[model samples]
Target: MRAVVLETAGPAPHLRDAVLPDPQPAPDEALLRVTACGFSHHDALIMEGTLRRGVTLPRVPGHEVTGVVCGVGDGVPASLIGTEAVVVPGDIGHRRDGGFAEMLTAPVASLVPLPQGMAATGGALLASPIGVALRALEACGVAGGETLVVTGASGGVGAHAAQAAHAMGASVIGITGSPEKAQRLEGKPWLDAVLLDDEPWEEVVAALTGDMGADVALDTTGTSLGRLAAAMRHGGRIALVGQTSPDAAPFAPAEAIFRELTLVGSLGVERRHVERALSLVAGGQVTPLVHEELPLSVESVTRAYRAVKRREVLGRVVLRPVGF
Candidate 1:
């Protein structure tokens, strides 16, 4: 089958095509005919050599995928064949060929059945970003009536995190770098307010929270928005998820210590968190924030990677293996 292979990693991904051997599923795995895959900003970071580790050259870089089961390995349940499922981009994407192909293999444990009405594009995103959002909220221990701030609030993880935090009864303050994003989040039930990163953060935070700081802040941009640190109340918790800003610095040790703030770093979601994200989407309590869809082809993959590198899109960008 044809797959978009990354020939090299540099400032941008080098995407090309190659005819290769079909993937063979392991005993506990399933072979999926990928229908959709989510292109992440992290993919660009991986390509640029900034986010090191996990990626192997001549690779297919896609983790958030959704597809139908076409085959199953020994000891796997035969009933899964023909079922629509979400492919969890486990650590395998960085090590193995991922969903940028017509077919991909994943452990049965990593597949989540699509909810009755969830589209493949939406299902694809639920696997990674949504799972991360759920885990971030869990780590921060956000509660009802509390005020939470979400950075990069228009991106996939940030959007989902804001919605999830709202579902958990917290009032969400969304922060984004664009005016369009600020307008997008305004008046949304999930977000009590939206602030532009260009504004003075102290004024923005003070205006949003009535002079008090947020009870919790989830920084998805990974920028040195020290204003985010300043916007937190003493003893509040902060969860660092991504580093969108190349210049982001470590938190001031003194501030964190003196304020008794909790700063935590979150990695990929665990099995249970993935399950919870799926359940939330299945229940219609949360929606996947998809920005655009491109065909699953070498050219489109390259374009998508470049778009992400340029920060030109919002939410999740999906590639459709099959025409949608």
Candidate 2:
């Protein structure tokens, strides 16, 4: 197996390709022949040594993995062989060896089979940000005919949240910092409006909702909690889904109490959420935005990490193994 290993963590981490023995599945695990893996900000944080708690050194860091099941160990069904699957990179990339290689192992319970002919590139993104978005929308309890505000709507998770909320019959408002990005979000049929982050977003939302305020808000930027609360109707729900900001947003407890607003913090998603997200992608109800596809190698992997670190890449950046 060829893998990229981060032998040490620092402000500048080193990556090298090493040939190692192929991983064998545990009794309850499946061996995956990695087809595509997506680079995430989590990977960049690990490389920069900004996120090192519970991290094991000399790691292969890639969690957004999509691949085929080549073999299954004991307690697994043989029928899974040759089936295309997406592995929920459950702490695999962060705490253990992950799918930055030609092969990796995942628990059978963590593998979601892909619909026939569905691209693994999309599958690679389904279980993470996509699933997270679904969970956040659910937490917000977005309903038909309601107004849903999606902060950081041009981002990976935010875009999917907007699409999901729109599909659920909510009128979606997207908030983005870049006008060009907002234009792209506006072009989507699912979005009802796009607001620049620098604008008076609360006033805009109030006007859009006819002064009633938005019914639900998904804050992907993490810096908009206060703004989300302000733009939301009384008894509305706000789902906090990201930590992009280094500092927490100032909260007005009295306002939250007076309005009876519900603030929910959403973290990782469950397996069922991943399954639903995958079905949506497989059915073409929502498309995960893919920025670029690069072949898996030391150079490509390093470049992808750099792009993610610089926050220059839009959508998911996928890496295909050599043969793929």
Best by TM-score: 1
* lDDT per residue (tens digit) for residues 1-324 in model 2: 889888887877888888889999999999999998988777777877877767898898888898899999999999989988887667887777888899999999998888888888888989877888898888878899999998888777888888888878899999888877776667798789999988898999999999999888899877878878888888989888876657988778876787799999887778888999988887778898888999888788789878766656667788888853
Report how far residue 287 has shifted in candidate 1, in Å: 1.0
Q: C-alpha displacement of 152 in model 2, angstroms?
A: 1.7
If candidate 2 were superposed on the true structure by all CA atoms, what would the RMSD be?
1.8
Error of 1 at 124 (Å): 0.4
Q: Which runs in model 2 stand beyond 4 Å of their true positions?
A: none
The 0-to-1 C-alpha lDDT of every candidate, in the order given, reads 0.83, 0.84
lDDT of 1 at 196: 83
Error of 2 at 162 (Å): 1.0
Worst 10 residues of 1 by lDDT: 248-257
Number of colliding residue pairs in each model: 1, 0
